[model samples]
Target: MVNITINGKIVQAEEGEMLLSVIRRLKIDVPALCHHEAVEPLGACRLCMVEITKEDWNGWSKFVTSCLYPVEPDLIVLTHSDQVNEIRRTIMDLYLARHPNSPEIQKLAEEYGVLKTSYEVQVDGDNCILCGICTRICDAMGFHAISLVGRGHGKTVAPPLDEPPPDCTGCLSCALNCPTNFIEFSDQGNKRTIWKKDFEMLACVKCGATTITREFAEFLSRNRDIPFEYFETCDACHRKETSLSMGRIAAWTKEAQS
Candidate 1:
């Protein structure tokens, strides 16, 4: 256990844990977004910036992303210093200028006491707030069906050229992974047939058996597109994999054969 001092108080942490994890473990005050232990830590938001001062270190330091920053023995960290707070507030303001209707960003701004920004609030047709959390999650989870496109102020998260992304398994992983709730699956989408709601990713199981409200086989057949060969398995498939590797696939097979 390393005795890391946060604002002069010694706190202990195990190896490989981040400073944000350490602070949370110590019940210290820190701010964060897009920081979930269950998912990979991407330092995109820069909202969890902290001021870290070590024993051997000189001068105050600003850290943009605490989720990825590590804490070591004898480490000294200051979570909320004047400089870090100002930068965070500025970032928040810029985000607000772009997305005034975003509840998530507004709540964070309120926490930091950011009243408002001088820049005009622009509204895009899409529900995305451009946090990059959704796209990042898809990539981290090995579902590279979507991406952020364009550049500078014109960036948008979507499939390339607004075409139906081939990698999409109708899993609703994009909708599930999104932060702003931008995508709403429905029976209607003009880009392609697979964009329809009935073709969305259906959950079954990890095993190659079972039926549910949405099945990959059904989706794949309807879309006339099956980019990946091994899109089998349902949520409950993992638990029953050891036994009966094959089951009353007879019913489905007959149905399939017909």
Candidate 2:
């Protein structure tokens, strides 16, 4: 166990666990962007910066990304110091400058007391902050479909050349995990469109609900080398169907009587 002092309170934490875990476990209010429990932390937003003072260090405390920093014994951490707050404000302001109209970024700016930034706003680009959560989640899901395109300020989230690759299964994981709502998907007829790729959806036989993408279903089956015939059924319809089929002899007798 690692013993650390967070905001002057002593806490015991596991070694190598992220400092954000300790801070969150202590119930300290810290804003997080580009962070989700299911996905790996990228620390791209820099919103979780906190002041840290090592036990043996003589220099001034330094700011670090709490989500990426590992917990260490005898470490002293401050989550909401003036320096930490200023860094958070600056980060939020920069994000706001890039995405002034985004409600999510606007809310964070308002919460962090940053009404606006002196930097010029680029209007022609999308509101994505380049946090890479979408790309990371897609990679984690084993589909290297979407990615951060271009370089520096010119970068944006999309599949290569704004066109989805053949490997894309339209799983929608990227759109689902995006923090800035920069990704969009649509379903029309039997086609689901995302990342400039269209996928055929498997409709549930009983309820006609679109269950999953045909490409994604095929990927899962082929990757796992398993046959799962029920993938075409949505959960609700599947449950209803399984319940009806539970007792075939009784169902036959009931149907005959009816």
Candidate 3:
């Protein structure tokens, strides 16, 4: 454990843990767009920048991204100092210029008092901020389907060869984890389509309701060692079965006691 001071409050945090995690645990509002607990921290979004210093550093301090900076003993962190807020405001201003159409970006920028960007707005720009959260989450799921292609302003997340990803099972991990909601997919009846690839949706045998994609269920069953038949039922039916089984057990116990 390491003792750290945040906003004049001394707190104990696990050594080597990221400062952003500690700040969040303390209920401090630090806006971070590219961070997800399911994957390793990528300091792509500079919104979580904070000022830090140590008593032995001769009063000199430096700004660091909290999501990637690990906590150290006697570390002094200022999450919303004047310099930190200025940095965040600048980043938000740029974001507003680049993603003017994105509601998420607009709301966050408004919080930082960036109602209008000083830079020229890209009116035709897509909402993608290029934070790489979607690509990172897709990679963490063990499917190298989508990736950031090109360089500089031309960079974008796309399937391999600019075609439908063969390895994608319509898992929706990339689309769901995207902070900007840039990825789009559609579901119609028993058909699910994402990345221009169509997948057959799995239907519950007991309730006839749609569940996940069949390919995802099979992948889970094969890799996670779960029974394939378990995916045949939807979550509601499974809960119903579990309740019935528990009720029967209780009745059996009562009868035996009598």
Where does model 1 exceed 4 Å of error?
27-29, 123-129, 186-258
lDDT of 1 by residue, 178-212 (tens): 65556666533212133333453333444334332
**Candidate 2 residue-wise lDDT, 1-258, digit = tens:** 978999998899999999997888778989887787777888988899999998779866888999999888899999999888988988887887778888888888898899987689867757788888888888888888878788976777777777568779988887877777878889887899987778899887777788689889899998988676768778998777778787786889999999
lDDT of 3: 0.93
For model 3, residues 1-258, the per-residue Cα lDDT tens digits are: 879999999999999999999999999999999999999998999999999999999989999999999999999999999999999999999998899998988899889898999999887899888889888888888887889999998988899888999889898988888888899999899999999999999999988888899999998999899999999999999999999999999999999999
Error of 1 at 46 (Å): 0.8
Best lDDT among the predictions, by candidate number: 3
Best by TM-score: 3
Which TM-score value belongs to model 3? 0.96
Candidates in order, TM-scores: namely 0.68, 0.89, 0.96
lDDT of 3 at 107: 91
What's the candidate order when arranged by decreasing TM-score?
3, 2, 1
The all-Cα superposition gives candidate 1 an RMSD in Å to the true structure of 8.7
Pairs in steric clash, model 2: none
